[model samples]
Target: MSIFQIKQKTSGAVLWTGSAHDEKTALDAMAREAGYADYASLPDQIRAGGVQAAKLDLIS
Candidate 1:
């Protein structure tokens, strides 16, 4: 597994950070738990500028 960091795209706020088999799975899981429709919708929401934050960093 690799550690990943998910942050607020605009503010750079650290949202979720953990280890996962892959980035997509991690994002999907986080989105789902946070009540999002799906992983793809996350970026759309983020682009709306505040609907939701979307930034991912691989931290090992």
Candidate 2:
């Protein structure tokens, strides 16, 4: 597993930080952190410019 960090694209604010096994899990964590039911529930703007996720170094 690896740590993931989600941030706001525009403001560059850290939104969510956690460990996820895959991209899907990281995206799910990002969506939930933004208070949406799921990734599909997020608006286009939110998906495009509001938030983004990147895999960090692997967890020991």
Candidate 3:
């Protein structure tokens, strides 16, 4: 199922107020949304764990 989340932009730690099957999935969703469509290489982050806070909010 889908879920909602709030993540600290400097720590990569995520907080969710909805149901998810697991934490990895939750982090994945957060990174994808926060990173947006340019996240073409994002799912890769999940391969090693979620995105680092430094990688988020990039305007490029």
Best by TM-score: 2
Tens digit per residue, CA lDDT, model 1, 1-60: 666666666787766776767777667666776788766766665635542323345455
Model 1, residue 32: distance off in Å is 1.7
lDDT of 2 by residue, 8-28 (tens): 889998878899897678888
Candidate 3 collision pairs: none
- Residue-wise lDDT of candidate 3 within 5-40, one digit each (tens)? 545444666633444455555555555655744334
lDDT of each: 0.63, 0.82, 0.47
Point to the candidate with the largest lDDT. Answer: 2
Candidate 1's clash total is: 0
- List the candidate numbers ranked by lDDT, top first: 2, 1, 3
Cα error, residue 28 of model 1, in Å, equals 0.7
Candidate order by TM-score, decreasing, is 2, 1, 3
Model 2 bad stretches (over 4 Å): 58-60
Model 1, position 18, has a per-residue lDDT of 68
TM-score of each model, paired residue for residue: 0.57, 0.70, 0.32
Model 1 lowest lDDT segment of ten: 47-56
Q: What's the C-alpha lDDT at position 28 in model 1?
A: 68
Q: Model 2 clash pairs?
A: none
